[model samples]
Every structure is written in structure tokens, then in C-alpha cells.
Target: MLKTVRSVSIADYAKSGVLILPLLSSRKRKAEERRGKTVRKKGQERLLQGNEAIVEGALRAGCRFFAGYPITPATEISELLSVRLPKVDGTFIQMEDEIASLGAVIGASLAGVKSMTATSGPGFSLMQENLGFACIAEVPCVVVNVMRGGPSTGLPTSPSQSDVMQARWGTHGDHPMIVLCPSTIRECYDLTIKAFNLSEKYRNPVILLVDEVIAHMREKIILDGDKPIDIFTRVKPTVPPEWYIPYEDTPTGIPAMADFGEGYRYHVTGLTHDTRGFPTSRPDEVDAFIRRLFRKISQNFTDMQMGEVFQTEDAEVAVIAYGCVARSAKRAVIDARERGIRAGLLKLNTIWPFMRTQVEKILHTSGCVIVPEMNMGQISREVKRVNKGTAKVFTINKVDGTIITPQEILGKIREVC
Candidate 1:
């Protein structure tokens, strides 16, 4: 006997606290079948590219503007947005390069439209200047980097975790940034949506860390309209239009954004600014503005540390990984369990803000932590910093353009354990 999934109404989502929508409706009796089922009302479940998934997620998140240059493994995002944006009454533009792409996205975001841009490592390198500009200006937008090998076009078609550090501090100077790395294909679809929400809520740019392997790998993602997705619009000030100070916060660290045509004559600039959004050369004003910008993100660390734990309870060894490496680490944990190694996996959906407290809790119960990344060990250093000498932090780093396999991670675990 085949059991069918019950389709629920949109209002029912809030009432039951569980959203039952059609993803890919499966005929099988397995728990992991959600990714394979396609609910027709929401969207059909077919083979979707990672870049396309990002495009869909952005659109669903109320992103009305997209600007980007076509780059390897991430071109599909721009290609899809070019056709989809106009149909949805949104705007899409192909810029001269990644720098212009980010410039356009920031301008549109300032105009009260949720905007996004997609690129790979080389393009990402060029966009850093404008990324810094968006940070200083407190612009809300999403940037998806389908990461390939780095260090000046190291490997275009290959997957690499080389940009993990770049996503955090590449823009230079003192700034707080939110970076989310998706391990699963489903997360590619889901986290892209969340990226926009966080960007809008915090009034900062959110980077979607997509590696090349996950970006190109075709996955059967179940699209369901019934899923209760949080779409956060930019915070609007309750103060009167004339009385509104754009840079002033409302206790929640987020300053209300005034769009370009909103009649709120606020000025925004790359240089240090003040409460009225005007540039100031005063030392106190510059100091206050920079600190507030960092606090807007650092203060929300509680909301930003999104992660998944696999068999962490009573584990002696833990595997910490993110992005495509997480998928491999999951299998390694299972294999280690069968061998009586008591290995666990901490898969990070939020890579930035480092989640040091949560990691400390895990380290208190574990003997060793293994960090497997596709680069020359970026996150392992963070793991070490968080571990604080409580546990031995070992790293398995590979930058040969291929994903770190489960066997590779298992070998590292064996050596460390």
C-alpha cells in the first residue's frame, strides 16, 4: 500500500506549526525522500542546477533586482534571473564586470529593492572593492559566490574551499559580515532564500558560499509552496518622515533603511557617516559609525549561528565541516560509528561569526575535532581558536579542485583519533 502526502493550505502552516506542502511526492517509504518529491503546486521536482536553485531561492525571497556577470559554474544564476526578473516585474542587468554588478545591486538595494549578484572566485576578487563599499554604506543585498579554485583563476571548473576566509575578511578593514555555506543541494535552494532575509533584516550584504561541485551537481529538490519561509523586508522607521534619522537604531541594532524614492532625503556614502547618513570627517563620528556597523552583525550572533549536529551526543571525536565537504563528512561519521570510533559531525550552515560558544559546548564532550575543507585549511584555524586547546583539532585540506571524499576524511579521523 502506497501512502500519499496530505496537501495542506497556506494558512494551515501557522496553525499547526508545521508546513506540509508538496516537495517531490515520493511513492517510497523512506525519510530522506523529501528531496526527490516534486509538489506541482509549489514547483515541479526535476533536475535543477545549483545556480538555478539559487536563482529560484532569491526570487522566492522577494529579491526584485539582480545584476551580475556570467562566470564559470555560476552563470546559470544570472541567465535564469535575466528571464525571470522581468516576468515578475523585477529588474535584471548584465554589467560590464563583477565590480559593476555589485555596484548596481547596492544601488538597487538602496532604492528599496532586495537585490542580488552571483559570481565565482575570479569575479568575486574584482567585486571586493564594491563589497567593501556596501559594507561601509550598510547596504542590504545578497551575493552568491559559486566558489571555484582561487588565487587568481587557480581552477575555473574545479571545486575549492579556498574562498572561505575571503568571504569573511576579503573586503578589508573592520566590518561585520554574514557568510552562509550550504552543504546540501536542498540548502542551496533554502539558504539562498535565508541569505536575502538576513541581508534585509540586518541591512548588510549576505554571502551565499556555493562551491563548484554543489553548484554543478544536479539534485532533485522538492519545491513546496507550503513551507513557511521567513521573508524579511528592510526595517522601516516608525519615526515621522521628517524626523527619521536613517542611521539611528531601534534597540535591535538594525537601523531603518530609507529607500531612494521614499521622500526621506538621506545621504549614503562610502566614507564614514553619521546618524543622518551624511559623511563626516569628525573622529568621534567615524569611530561611532564603524563600531555600530560591526555591532549590527556581531550583536546578532545568536540568530546567525545556524548549524546541524550528527550523532554528537557522547561522541569522542567530532568532524567539523561545511559546504560540499559536509556531505562527505556525514558519510565519514557513519563509517566511523560502524568502526566504534564514536565520531560525530558538526555541519555549519552559517560559516561566519564562527559560533565559538556552540563549538565550545561540543568540545567539552569530545576528545578530538577533525576539520575537512576543500582548501589549505581555513576553517580549521577557527576550529582551533574555538577549541582553545580543549580538543585536538586536526585538518584534512585539499585544493586540487576536487571535493574531499568520505574516505579521505575517514583517514584523517583515524590518524587524529
Candidate 2:
């Protein structure tokens, strides 16, 4: 015989029956199911503008301090973060100019908060001096440069890859730099995270380059909130405040940073300084300081160098491009293959600390290489330097404040083949 089963509430026991508490009510159960769906849906794809993706990626990477001036193409980053940051207990400040913007970012980073700023070509030019200071201080921060045509405000509302060289070399002196070029909305998100990670890991400045087309264009990207991301954080001093040396020499070549208010007595200056953070003009100490700054990057070239090789295996003609131009070149490579041409494309995601090894590899495999840029062939100059007349290299350069087209790249490929 089956035993009888009865469901009773705790209230029934108080009245005169058994004390049985229900775990949940029908209303509560339904509410939980809806919440589960919302959480799962965050892992699905969403249509996002490129700058929006940058904002999302930065928050995902744990950036809590944002200081920047409003500029075309990249304005949405600061505007959106103004509203989003406070909700997460983060700080957002709009500076009077780009110069002040990067300054505040550096100050925030020194206080132990991950920081970033955004601007266009003109504003980027203004920040170069401060960028150099951050380099000497070894402060970690990210700068997002939305490429607009210009030497000095040529095309504020148009797209141009003219800032390629400036992103790497605009700052004064021979400072070590890391610049990332993202060609898609997904890359805009992914690379921004990588930029912050690199900055933190190396204790250096990192720049993420996008263009007007990339900044405003929309694309479907799965920025999965549930997915695990590889984030690198700045190493802090392990020793007590009395023993802390902000710029102490380490085997990894990266000095540990301490928060400003943590009672760590350390100096910070723009001048070439000794490990004690004090200015030293002695040849031995100056040489050591500069060498260590570059050594941090040189020692880790294997991990820092990044690029994508598409259809380059056994190809006769290869096109080297970055940013949105890479998109056109990708299509051109496919079109060339359709017409029975052995054409390939090398898309660079890391622009600086130039991929000499990878570029040489492509040069060896291909008879001819073409570099298409929206500038007057800045990167092509670097390619030619590495080629050194070993390969037939050509360039497709445009500086009329426009982007390179697939037809332009395909025509060059066909001609070369």
C-alpha cells in the first residue's frame, strides 16, 4: 500500500497542525526563471557600435577611472562611461583639454586604479608630451585614438589611418610603446582589453587605434559577460612601506607600483632618474634606467608581437594592412583567389615594436608585397626597410581623408601577380 503524503505550511502548525515550510512560492519561482534567462542572454550576441564595444571592453577589463575630453568619433566612449561608471562606483571626469585628460588618467593609475582616456588625432597630438612623462614614470594607462585625417585638424569628421606612425612615435624621445590596431567591432572590444592588460603587465602606456568608420559602424559581437577573460594587473610592492622602492630593479624588468596614499615613500619625475626615482645625470645610472625601460619590452617581444596571417602560405602576392583597410584587403585577397591568383593578406593587430620577424616571413614566401594605408605610406616605409630590396614591394597610399578600398587593393594584387 502507498503511504499518504501531504504538503503543509508552517502557518498550519501554528494554527494546530504540522510545521512544514515551503521553500518557495509560485511567484518567486517564476521570477527566478526570468532572471536566469536574462543572465544567459548576456552571453549571446548584441549589435554594438565600435566605441560602445570599447566602453564595454574597458569595464570588463576592470577600468575604474576615466578622464578625457570630448572629441569626434571617440566622444561616445566618454559620454557613455559618464553614465555607466558612477553606477559601478567608478570615477569619471571631463578635462578642459586632452592634455589635462591624460594627466588625470596618470594620477588615477598611480593611486592604484586602472585608468583610460580617448581622443582623436588633434587631441592625441596634444597628449604626446604627457604620454612621454607617463613613460618615464612607468604608469599604466590606455589611450584610445580614433583616427581622423590630419597633421593639425585636416578632417575631424572623416576617417584616416594617418595616425599610424604618430601612435607609435608622436611622443618625444625613444620611449618603448605598444599600439594595438583593431579592425572590427569584436576586435575593438577584445583589443581594448588586451591594451589594458599589456599596460598593466609592462607598466607602460598602451594605445588602441580605431578610425571614424570603425568608431561609428555597428556590428554583432558576443561580448559574453559569463566568459572568462585573461586580465593582467600591475604588480604591487611586496615589501613594507619602509622597504618599498617604487622603481626597484627586478629580473622581469618591471618595477612594482604602490598606491599613492599607502604610505609608500617614492618619488616620480619626468627626468631620467635612478632606481630611487631621483634625478641622476650620471652616465651609468642614466644608461641603466633607459635600458631597463626598453628591456622590459625587448625581453618579452615573443608575447607582445601579434599579427594575423591569412592565405599567406605559398602565395605569390601578399597585402599588408591594418585597421579598417585590413577589411578591404581581406576581401581583395578572396577576390584575387577567385580570379586564379595566389594572393594573401597579413593583418596587423599590433602595430608598434614592429613585427619584423613576421613581415620578413611573409616577404620570404611571397614574390611581391603591397602595403595599403590611408596615409602617405608610413608603414610601407617600415616594410621596405625590412625588405631591404629582397622582395618587390609596392604601396597603395591615400591621404584625401578616405579609406583604402578592396578594388584598389585587388587591382594592385592583380598587377603584382
Candidate 3:
């Protein structure tokens, strides 16, 4: 029997400090059964790990170069690419280390090849400096960080969401960053393609952040191989080689990129450069360069800051979550509704360049908002910042190399309501 939320009452839960678990109604049971049944799509449906789906997405998105070091949890990405890239006439290299891996990827992209690299926590840390170089150079490339428990290879194979802050701040200085989180196997494939498109369109390094759970989890998904997918490539300079300016700012703030050996001699550097790509120390030139990078992304928030809202139309309470933990949050929301609570959920797809406007609206509307993550309040902090006391903010943080359960989130909802 199903019960609508708060039907069991705060007083009832308070007496025992436990939410009464209700059996799913027949309708609910049928829905679960439908999800469990395998698809019968011919030549399209197959079981794949999240990491493997990413490789497929990359190939489909026209990724031709992959240079990476083998690291636990992320090793499959490199391993699979090595086999797949060759079949497609693409290039793949096992670099000496993470730093060199990104360096190679940067070089490949500069030569007009779509390139990428994958790494775990420690390797991600090592790539930070090189990643900063990519940002300043405005190189179009992709970096996949398969997060694992860590401070110093803390738990190489265990799951953890502690890298949320690191992904945004890992590189020394602030330029523009795009970090995406995928919660499902299908998203792993779709977002990887989207990541490549965004990188080429913006001529910037894009990070695809995947934790252990999603990276290794296996599920049935349709590859959609026959679908006509939209792909974006960097705009190349049509001007004569002698007239090309590699870093010239445009109305969209994205400059036309030229391949290194395309007969256009342009300097690429970590130093602040102007239109000619030559290092400039002039105050005005540096200011324009930095502002242009920020403008290209910030001005395009609608296309960049992506998220999904569930049951929020009439919701009085909401749960904000992302990555694998979002699955749990969704289940909790449905259960809350069954128990007669008007609860909702918001799952963030873009981690950085936070979705502030949508979050602010939810904060203003909901009586209370709960943010549950694998890290200790990393995203919750952002929610609270946007809150401004519009709604009471609560957090359910877990960082013990384990996941936060739906039951755990329900308990918090029960207590708060």
C-alpha cells in the first residue's frame, strides 16, 4: 500500500527516528518491472559500461586522437580507445604520464585533430598545470577525469565525489572552465559527444567528470548508431595565411583557429597574447584577452549551464544532487510523493559555471531544499550561496568511499518537514 508524503507525520517519525517504509503499490511495481525488462531493439541495444560508452561517444563525435596513461578506474577508457581508434584510422598513444598525456593531446588538437585524455585523481592533479596552459592557449581539447577516493591515491578503486571543487579550481588561475557530470550510462555517451562539440565550438578545454560508480556500472543502452547526430568543428581561418591572426576576438568571443602547419605562422603560449598570438605585456591587451575568454562562456549560459528538474512545478521541498547520487535522489523524491509530500529534485549536468538562476528560483519557491552529494557540502555550499535565506537549506554529505542511500535522504526530509 502506498501513502502520500507527511501522511506518516513528522511526529510519527520523531517517535522512532525512522521513516516507515511502505510497500510499492501495484502500479509502482509495474513501472519497476518495465525498467528491469531488457530492450528488444535489433543491432542497437547492448550492455556497456559507462567508460566504454564514452569511447563509443568519442568515436561517434569524430575524436581522432587519444593520448593517456593507464590508471585504475580510468584505464578502460584508454584501453578501449587504443583498440577502437586504430579501426577508424584515428591515433592513440600511451603516454609516459598524465602531464605528457595532456601535452600530447594539446599538440594533436593544435594540428587540427580532435583529441582527448583520461585520468584518475592523482593523474588529474598532475594534469592541472598543463590544463592551465591549455586554458590560456585556448586549445580545443577534452579531458575526462574518472574520480576515485583520494587525497594521495587514497582509495584507487573506491567511489568518491571529493573532486567537485578540484575540477573547478585544480588549475591555478581562473579562465573559463566547462565541467560536466553524467549520472547514467546513456548520458555518459551523450555528454561525451556534447563535450567534444562544446570544446570545438568554444576552442577551449572541456572536462568530463565521471566518478567510479558510473564509470564502471553496466547497463543496457541503445547506441543510436544510425541516427544523424549533429557535430561541431572549430571554425578555421579563411583569410590568407599572411593575414591570419590566431587569437583575434570575434563577436562571439571565439577566435578562428588555424592548424600549426597550415602555412599560417602564429605563436601559441601560456603568456597573455593578443590577436597575433604574440605574447603581450601591454595592460589593455591583457585585459581584453581575459575578458573575452570569460565573455564567450558567461554570455552563453543558457547553452552551457544544463540541468534537469523533476516534480518541481508544485514542489514545496526540493532535493539538489548530481552524478550517480542523483539516481538515489530521484527514488527518494518519488517515495516522498507517495508519502504525501510535495517534494522535487534538481540534477545538475554542468558542475562549473553553476546553474545559479534556476537554483535561485527553486530556492525562492521551495520551503526547504536538500542538497545531497558524495562530498562534504561542496555543491550544497553553492546552493546556500544562491539561497540568501529564501528557503531553509539542508545537506546530506557522504565521503566514506560509499554512496548515500535513498533511505538516508528520506530521513533528512522527514526530519526537516
Candidate 4:
């Protein structure tokens, strides 16, 4: 009953004329246990930079193609993907410039791959044209813009949220966009996944806005290995190749996307096109195309809008903010509450289509809405527009490349209260 288990070499087994099947099986089981332990270790919680979290999130979302150029505060994303993407059988390309980066991404997405690209402010400016093209052509892709102090490469390493307006309206034409801003490292991961999902579901591009402060800063995060993430892939055409129309409008306003070389040969162009995907200069066709593009996003904004409200139910003063600046606002609200002031925070995780209903509710209920941002009141203007004389809107702005601290926001809360 006390038989000992010992390792036997292949040579020893052959010399002793013994069957080595049992010993080989034992070794295989031990090896598998060691591998399982290694995998578990790899999946355990660890500290991660925001940029690194973004790369992990994209990979988890089944992103198979990435094309981006080197840019500050965002180059790390491209670098990490270069190594990790190959491991997942994905492709990574360093394009000649930001324009080509987005072009390559659009091409890859058209080829039926979930693709993404990352850049900072300067590079972001360069990609606006193609961004609009992705919108008009109904190509689903994700673009990450890491904010840095900028107006033509102002400060590459410094944090600034000056691109809020640009993220919304940088392109030339009247197009709809969904922009998600994350306040923490964990949010950087979660929102990037959401960006991909929303883009695919809507058949348009989605922007993930990250500032320098969050992008480069390191923080510990608990990544739940058991949590299931909902992934949305583009709907493929069910009809035969001859019956497929790439731009066939549906009730949902999203057309079925057919991959190239899938027997569905359809045209795609940045110009206004018809259901068959051919360019049309007719005014009615152009009008219909534009309206459908806008309707797809504007009508479905309710499903796309996501926000967080803390202590807002009965508060007299509500603070509305987003991005990394919202972190300070949350702390300010908690501190104000401790000091017997009824203060709350409305954190906008989805910045575009502007949370009009939530802001209206907050304005009607609260005596005043205080918006503190790192930029010069870009979103505060939207808050004021939504408030519409119902409540006084106050903005606290800082654009000096420094983060808006909690104490600064608390002071504003005290003053407003």
C-alpha cells in the first residue's frame, strides 16, 4: 500500500525492460498542474497602467487588427499590441502617419476584423478626415485618443482635457459619434470594451477619450476572471451574394455588413451612397443617407448613454463632470456630504449625445449644477444648455496642464452651496 513514486529516465526504462506508461502519465499530469498554476498566476490581480489596461481590454474584446503610429502617452499601446497581438494571431502595423493609421484600420474593419488605433492630440487631429469617412461609410472601428497639452504639439507629456470638443466635432461634416471618457485605470479597460461593442452594434466609429493623467498613471485593479463580457459583432448579410445590398437600411438604421470576398461584392465610398453602396449625387439620396446616419445614433442614444450619480437623490447641489476630472468631483461630493452639505456628483461615462435627460433631472431637482473640468468649460456649456434657466450652472475650469484637485472642487461645492 506504500508504493513510492519515482521518476524513471527513458533509458532506464528500456534497460530494465519495464513499461513506462504509468510513469509517463504521472509526468504529464504534473506538467498540466504546473501549467494550470502558471495560467492562474498570470490571470491574478496586478497593477497596470491605464494604457496597458486599454490594450488588454481590446484584446479581450476580440480585436484582431491594430494600426497606429508612434505618439506620446499612447505609443505604449501600439508597442504592447505589437507583441501581444501576434500571440493571439492578430495583426499589428505601424503606419506611416496618423492618416494612414486610420485608413488601415478602416480597411481592416471592412475586411471583417475588429480593428482599433491609438494616438495623442496631434495625431488625433490628423485622423479626423478618415474618422468622418468611417462614419459616412458605416465602418465600425474604435479610436483611442490620449489627451496631452496641445495646440500643435504643445506639451507631449503633460495632461490636458482640451480635446473634448474636438472629439465631438473635429471632422468636417455633420456626422454622429459616440465618445466614451474613462476616469480610472479600470474604467480605461471597461470602456474600451464598450467602445468596440457600441461601434460594431451601430456600424460606426466610437472614440475612447483618455487624458495623460490616467493614461500613464499606474494603479492596482482587480480583474474578475469569472465575469462574462457581452461582445457585439457586426451583423452579416443573410441573403445570397446577388441579393446583398451593403447599405440596405433597416428599422434599426443599421445595415447588415458584408465582408469583402465573402461573395458579397458591394461598393463602399466616403461619398453619399444608395442601398446598393453606389455613390449618388442626387439631393434626395444624400439627404436620406445623412438622416439615416444621424438617426442611428441620435435615436438610439438612450441605449448608449451611461453615467454615474453619487448622493444625487436629495442633494441641493449637483456636480457634473467626466473623464479624470470626475475623480476629484466624486471626492469633493463625499467630503461635502461629511460636512453636512447636500452635494452630489453626476459622472458622464458617455460624453456624446450628451446625457440630456439625466442633466435635466438633476437641474430640476438640485438648486444648482457645478461643473468642474480640466478644460475651459466645454461640457459645462452643454450642462448650461440642458439646464436652460431651470437651475444656475457654475463652471470651474483649469487648463494649465495640472489635474483639478479634490480640494479645488470641494471649495467650489462649498461656495455654490
lDDT values, one for every candidate: 0.82, 0.86, 0.86, 0.86
CA deviation > 4 Å runs, candidate 4: 1-43
Can you write out model 3's per-residue Cα lDDT over 1-35, one digit (the tens) per residue?
01123323334323221222334666765676488
What lDDT, from 0 to 1, does candidate 2 have? 0.86
Q: What alpha-carbon RMSD in Å does predicted model 4 have with respect to the real structure?
A: 12.9
Q: Which stretches of candidate 3 lie over 4 Å from their true place?
A: 1-40
**345-400, model 4: which lDDT tens digit per residue?**
78888999788988898899996999988888899999888777999999999988
* Pairs that clash in candidate 1: 23-37, 23-39, 24-37, 24-38, 25-37, 25-38
**Worst ten-residue run, lDDT, model 4?**
1-10
Each candidate's clash count:
6, 0, 7, 0
- Candidate 1 accuracy as TM-score: 0.89
TM-score of each candidate structure, all chains considered together:
0.89, 0.90, 0.90, 0.89
Look at candidate 2 and tell me the lDDT of residue 257: 88
Rate residue 362 of model 2 by lDDT: 87
lDDT of 2 by residue, 114-192 (tens): 9999999999999999999989999999999999999787897799999888988899898999998888888889889
Q: List the residue pairs that clash in candidate 3.
A: 3-338, 4-338, 4-339, 4-340, 5-339, 5-340, 5-341
Considering summed lDDT, which 10 consecutive residues are worst modelled in model 3? 13-22
Error of 3 at 1 (Å): 37
Model 3 residue 306 lDDT? Answer: 73
Local error of candidate 3 at 252, Å? 0.7
